[model samples]
Structures are given as structure tokens and as C-alpha cells.
Target: MTLDVSEADHQRVSEAIAVAETGTAGEIIAITAQTSDSYHDVGLHYAVAVLFFYLGTVAAWPPLLDWTWALLMGWSAPPSERAMLTLLLGVALAKFLFVLFVMKWMPLRLALTPGATKTRRVRRRAIMLFKAAAERRTEGRTGVLIYLSMGEHRAEIVGDAAITAVTTPETWGEAMAALIADVKDGRPADGIVAAIALIGEVLAHHFPRDAADRNEIPDKLIEL
Candidate 1:
């Protein structure tokens, strides 16, 4: 899935972040990802399911296979055990290829993935990005990461330990809710800016900028 953010939108968000940070010592990082995971395991599980289903069908209706063989060979005789095994293997191979083709369509692959799995992957990715990009990098450890995965329709807000100590998760609820609402409405850039504004307000209230404060992290949004 394409992230709806444009170059203009990136500049706007960067400006918003720069403005937001001026009021506080807190450092904010915004990241958008096309997807958090490939979900290949989900596809593999689907293929395995198809294999089992075909096997069960063959077992339940052995005559169907015999009829297939007869049609192909133009003979009514029942196949030998070896021939029957070969036919089952061929069916399995066909099913595998068919599932591989189906898995190429991302929507179908994602649909086969469990909701819990998607949530776990999104959260894990957000945490990873937070650590790689912003964790403990700020002078006062007042760093926060706002992460969004477009394909997964998931968002996460992660605050550094110092910020987390002073602010409850509820402090971010309004910002996150607004961001998600905008994303669901196909206004991802608007959602991100709104969330940043709200975060800026909270940070300004809790960690107002001091004369010694300096920008420790870049303001531009990160896209993956």
C-alpha cells in the first residue's frame, strides 16, 4: 500500500515537528511504513491448509481420483497404488503452486494473517524504529515516536522512559485517536500533523523548553 504522504506533506509535517519542539525539550519522531511484515508464514499456513483439504477430499472420495485418471488415460481400470500416490503428489504440487499465485496478491495474503499477529508485528516494528531512531538520544530522554503502518492499519506511540514516567498512556489517547481517525478517512498526512500538534501541547505542558535545550533529533518524517 502506498502511504498517502507527498513531498509537500513531508515538508509540512517536518515544519510542524520543528514548531512543536520549540515549545518543549521533548524530541518527536514520526515514521510511516508501507507494511510491518511480509506475512509469508500466513501464506504458508494457507497453503498447508489447502493441502490438507485436498488430501481429505481425495480420501473421502477416492472414486473421484479414479474417474480423473480414467478420463486422462481413457481407461476404466483402477490405478495401482503407486499411480494413486503419484496422482496425490501431483495434486499437492498443483495446490502448492495455486496457493503461491494467490499469495502474490497482498490483500489475500494479509487477510489470511491473524489480527493478533498483525498487531504484534506493528508494535514490534514501532518499538524497533523508536530504539533505532530516537530512544535515549535526547538530552532529557524526552523522546517520543509516532509510528504508522499503512498496510496494517496500525499506529503506535512510544515514549522514552523519562517522558513515560511523567505522562500516562492516557495522555496520548486523544492524539492517537485523532491520528487514527484521519488515517481511516484517507487523510494520513492530516492525521499525523494533528497528532503532532496534540503531542506538542502535552510535551510543552510537561517539559517546557529551557534556554539550554537544543534540537537533538531531526524534524523530518521517516518513511519506509
Candidate 2:
């Protein structure tokens, strides 16, 4: 879900938020992030895995060790134990470095990352952002964050303590489903707008607008 988010899309989301907030005191904040995490640690883990797998292969196959030794030192006498150890270390290091370098590309790194890891990372980031930008920000403590992570093709809805007290995470299933559907079809902006409308409905029901209600969070889509 690479963000091709346009100004018109942003305007539509802003307008959707405004309309949603008109009927509720809940402050809705929408944010779209290119990625939730860099996953450099995951890359390092991958490199280490590759290194170990290579070592294991060499250890499991005596012929492979001989081949590697020959490749490193051609037509020479059988290497000493110290030389073999150095050769294994050197080759393993090269494999590790090569994998690490390849993982520098974002798409490849993300593709190789496990789905559960991506989901967890996306959710974690959504919560962190919600805490920073929306949680307990409104007068009624009814702030909701609609977070979209394009890199992971995932979305999350986080409500402030006031809203969460009356509703469970499952309450946002419809909105999340709509968002995932639209995102899968490459309509990220439309997905966000639709999700906002649905979330607005929930907020209006759970926490209706008050006479003195004021907007605490900006009603615009943030792109990162």
C-alpha cells in the first residue's frame, strides 16, 4: 500500500473527520505511516541466521568443507585445522555481510519479515502514536486514532480511556475490515476516509456531542 495520497484525498479525509466530529465530542486523529518500523534488528537477525545456516551446511557436509577449502586455496595440500577454522569464519562473515547489505533495501527487508512481527510492530507503533497525539487529549478524554501503516498494509483504531471504557477493540471490526478491503485494492485514501466515517459513527453513539465540545485534535490525514 504505497502511499499515493494526494491533496484531494487529504481534503476528503479532513472533511470526513469534521463531519464525524460534528455529532460527537470524540477527537479523531488519522495518521498514515510509510512504515511502522525500520526492522534493522530483524535484518541483523536474518544475517545471523544465514551465517549459522551456512556454518551448519559446511559442518554437515565434509565434501562441502573440502570444496570450500579448495575454492579458497586451489590445488594446495589439505589445510590445517587453524586454516580451516579461519576459512569458515571468513566465509560465514562474508555471507552475513552480504545478507545484511541486501536487507538494506526496504521492500526486500519487509517482504522477508514475518507477518506476525509486522502486525505486532504496526500495532505497537499505533499505540505509541495514539498516546502521543490523541490519547486523553480532548476535554472528555474521548480521542480516537485511526492509524494506517502502508508498508505493512495494516490498520489500527485506538480509543482513549473514556471511549475504551464503554467499547472493546472488537467494536472497531467493521471499520478495520472496510479499511483493509480498500487498502488491498490500492485505495488507501478512500480506505481511510471510509474508516473515519465508521469510527465517527461509533464515537457519536458512545459519546455524543456536548454543547461545549471543542475540537482538540486536528482533522487532517498525516503522512509519514
Candidate 3:
């Protein structure tokens, strides 16, 4: 549960995660990630929204800034404080819409399984527990997402079920250890992901995605 991640391996680990979105957790589901600059995303959307909102303010400057401030903060403010609220209102609206639309809607549309949800929750718990335990023993995020982002010499167990799919846990652990070594030793993320996807494929061969299809896990995951 506890591990270390370093600074140099962040992108590699992130890329691996982005590509590892192929399987189901509880029953069968997919998860994915992508690199993003949220600051700019907020700024861009807010810039446009604010431009329009500001135009509305100009056309109908009926002292509605107080109401706008109330909407942003969930409380009212007097008109005397309407000077710099334009940017704030625009940014808040844009951010709320983004979270509601992209973060919320898109994931629901992905048709994730209850099993996948459980796995994700368990993954969070494991990581958090690792960090808490590490806090009892180590100095940093040895088992936290920070370590994953850092891409330290650490191997992650996706879950017990994931490991169970493999015939040999011993070999699986060894491969994971080797992967940790690879990342720590400066191997690229794509290569690391390729190695994992290959392992997933092998496991699928034995365990299979449906376990009934007798089909191989698609190789597409490796490309990610």
C-alpha cells in the first residue's frame, strides 16, 4: 500500500493512467484521464461569459450587481461593492457549469459498473490509508496520489480482483516490481503503460474480460 513517487515520473504515470481505462472494476467499466490546465479552462470560459455579462450590465445597469453577487456567494451584498464583481461572477458561473457538465455528466454517460465504482472507492481508501500509515512512518506522500503523479519507484495494485485475474500473483508482483524499477530507473511512461497493458492482455487471456468470451483483451489499451 505504501510507496514512493518522484518528480521526474509524473507525466509517465499520468499517461499510463490515461491509457489504463479499459476494464471494469466490479462488473465491467472504463475510466479515463487526460492532461488539463484548469486555470486556463476557467479563464477562457469566464472571459467570454464575463464579456457577455458585462455587456448585459452595461445595457441594463439596474443595480443588479448585488443580486449577481448573491448568486455567486449564495448571499446578498450591497451595490457599493459592485466594482470588481464582474470577473468573479463570470468565473464562478463558468466553473459551476464545467463541473456540472463535463465532470458530472460525462462520467455518468460512461456506464460504469457498481463494481468499478467500488474498486475506485477502494482504491481511494487504500491510497488514503497508505498516506495515513506513511504519516505514521514516513515523511511524504509515499502512498498517495502525489507519489503516483511523481512516478516514483513504486508499483500499484489496482485491486484484489485485478490481481486475482492473474494465475500467478507471485509473477504479477514481480512484474509490478519490475515496472516500479522501470519507472524509477527513468523508463518512459508509454513503455510502462505498454508493459501493464500487455500484462492485462495476458491476464485477460487466462481470466478474460467476460471470462466467458474466451477472448483476448484488446491491444488498444497499450497504445494509450
Best by TM-score: 2
lDDT by residue for model 1 (1-224), tens: 56578999999999999999999999999999989999988888888889888889888988878877877777856678998889879978899879978997898887778989999999999999999999989878899999999887789999998899998878899998999898888889999999999999999999999999999999999998
TM-score versus the correct structure, for each prediction: 0.92, 0.95, 0.28
lDDT of 2 by residue, 7-122 (tens): 99999999999999999989899999989999998899999999999989987886887788887689698789998888888989999999999999889999989999999999
lDDT of 3 by residue, 1-224 (tens): 12233344444544444343233211111112221112233334544565576557645874455555667566544534454456446655665566445534323323222334433444564355434432323111111111122111233343233344444545555545555565555554533555555555444444433433321222221110
Candidate 3 has its poorest 10 consecutive residues by lDDT at: 138-147
The full ranking of all candidates by lDDT, starting with the best, is 2, 1, 3
Model 1 residue pairs with clashes? none
Which prediction has more favorable lDDT, 1 or 3?
A: 1
Screening candidate 2 with a backbone cut-off below 3 angstroms (N, C-alpha, C), the clashing residue pairs are none
Query: What are the lDDT scores of the predictions, listed in order?
Result: 0.90, 0.91, 0.39
RMSD (CA, Å), candidate 2 to true, equals 1.3
How big is the positional error of residue 26 in model 1, measured in Å on the Cα after superposition?
0.5
Is candidate 2 or 3 superior in TM-score? 2
